[model samples]
Target: MRKPVLTIFYQYNPWQSTIGGIQSLINTFIKFAPDTFSIRLVGTGADNGQVVGQWHESELLGRPIQFFPLFTLLDDNVRKLVPTTVRYTAALLSKTLQSDFMHFHRIEPTLAARGWLGDKTLFVHNDIPQQMSSAKGAKTILWQQFPQLYFWLERQLMEQFDQVLSCNSASTKFYQQNYPSMVNRIMDVRNAVDTSCFKPLAPGPYQQAKQQLLDRLRLKPSTRLLLFAGRLHPQKDPLLLLRALAATPPESDIHLLVAGDGDLKSEVEQAIEQHNISSRVTLLGAVPKEEMVTLYQVSDVFVLSSRYEGLPIAMLESLACGTPVVTTDCGQGPSLLTSESGLVVSQREPQSLAQALVTVVDNPQRFTPEACMQAVSPHSAQHVVEPIYNSMLQRWHVSQANS
Candidate 1:
């Protein structure tokens, strides 16, 4: 039998170094997939005019995977402006044509490549339709305006795929009910974490790291640290964290670390000022991947104030590192959270979050490091993700034979 060639499509390239769940998931699949298949990562790259080489190649953990840049400039004349989308149409199509299977990590890129993807697959990182349905304020109004068009697009894009793998249980169920014709094609899998890298630190080192972070921030030794790490988007709801922080008691000895950046960053800053909690927050924008473990180790608890999520990797990473999570009832993250692992707010309100944060912050022993690590141990990448990849490869073979 010939070795299968699989290509994965995502909006951001692995080289971007942006803190995002989809990018992390693509890289994780590449690193953890069995060595039977040759993989290529396809994404839009922005290299303004500093093109060192046409094609970039490297190995992850000594395993090789090729990257085909959909939109990077080859000309030195173009300064820092992103070149036209028209220039990369041919490149994207050619890359898709040459692969045995093309996997998309988001719906936009999949819709962009509609009608021509051979042996196509789509991964649902977040449920867009569900988001629209449950959203408040402007989203509800906009969704109402184009409800028919939105549903039509959802149907049009999903019908052509050979398989659909979802990390969100709610998303899987949503597809199953609306598109009963394709229900057999969808498989639900947990978002994975590599336990080896994300596990907890020893006691002495943990305390040293905690104290160092507190000292660097000029916070007292008795301060309780809370970490909120993810893209500062509406889905992650960075502003909600600020509101929760404000709602905490006036004398609460706690500080929050915001570790990612996005469109909501300016709004987050505004909210912090409006809530009068500027002194209690630190914005650590776009943290390096190497330092993530240390970030989790120093915190008393990990916080997810998202409006919605598919099982966030950062939440899993937090738990794996012995840092319990306090989250809204967003998605799969809450399923893993227990009283011992963490707490989930009854609603997505500032007061609810504040109460939960105070509860966890005041009683650390009730949610110990060991219990947190034990809660997420079963979702290890090797155990949860490798089989999904293997099954995907098998499904690709079956699809091709039938075609």
Candidate 2:
């Protein structure tokens, strides 16, 4: 009768890879607890508005979603006329009005809303400002120039939340240790993987297309493939992967496949060319979500040398596909994954990464689909998320009774 005490956020869309992990969880949560609760999503734009098989706001597993503009003030107005602090305040007020329980997946807007959204759950996915504070030379200087306003704002917001979810233990400790006042509300909810969709590829479209890709490349009969899929950016540290690949033996019978696009696509291409590893490396720009299963099936290992990540969706997909993975120990997730099903290299080290790649490529049998599946089984939507939804509803009921 009380409409199950609504859950909502200004972030989530099935099509946007930036928040794909969060979107997947929301879709699954809806499926697992549809009878008891309903979720409304508010974000920048509508995923269904686009052509070319755009993902519905809540289209996964046949769920429906509602969306609205998240920012109250237009960017143009904020940039040209109003001061940042004032504009940010207006945006926060608008977003707080939009949702009952707010999940701030990114930092900028979350920091802007500091100490405002009373009695709302605030989940900070990462300490982006703190991470940026440690950046090199020019970047570090730029971050320090702001007099740590964003960092202070983030702390203030954390203090205000009724509940906080950290994606990994490291980040959980980050907020707890840094802002001890928030320790009580912090919860550790690692990113969940969509096991049904991402599991081992069936012998259908993915297989057929993969054969065509291999034939087109004139790839040898027994070549091991390494894959990297995500935005092309310095934060991902893709250039490190390039340098690492070039150091390997030219005739190692291994190849690297990069799938996705971003501003640094040109730079990555140039790095591949400069290394003269053109034959061994291929970049497939921005493959759609439906096609990712095929990409994983056609590959041997998935590598992510990111300098930072909360928990990469691609890593989970690759593991689900029965493909092995090699990633740098940049964030908490990689270390948690390394011993169970993949390799974890040190951050920003080309030689260490190259060695790990070679190791995985040589011993493909070391990694199995079952181990990967077991690792991610706990994080599956049905297993971990249903309770969260039920608890949220129960908590809301309790709050009302007390009131």
- Which digits, one per residue and each the tens of the lDDT, describe model 1 over residues 59-133? 654569776666654331121233223344445554434467788775545655676746787888765555666
RMSD of each: 4.2, 5.0
Return the TM-score for candidate 1, rounded to 2 decimals.
0.88
All candidates' lDDT scores? 0.77, 0.64
Cα lDDT, model 1, residue 254: 82
TM-score of each: 0.88, 0.82
Model 1, position 146: C-alpha lDDT score: 72
Q: Over the full model, what C-alpha lDDT does candidate 1 score relative to the true structure?
A: 0.77
Candidate 1 total steric clashes: 0
Q: Pick the candidate with the highest lDDT.
A: 1
True lDDT of residue 284, candidate 2: 79
Quote the positional error of residue 316 for candidate 1 in Å: 0.8
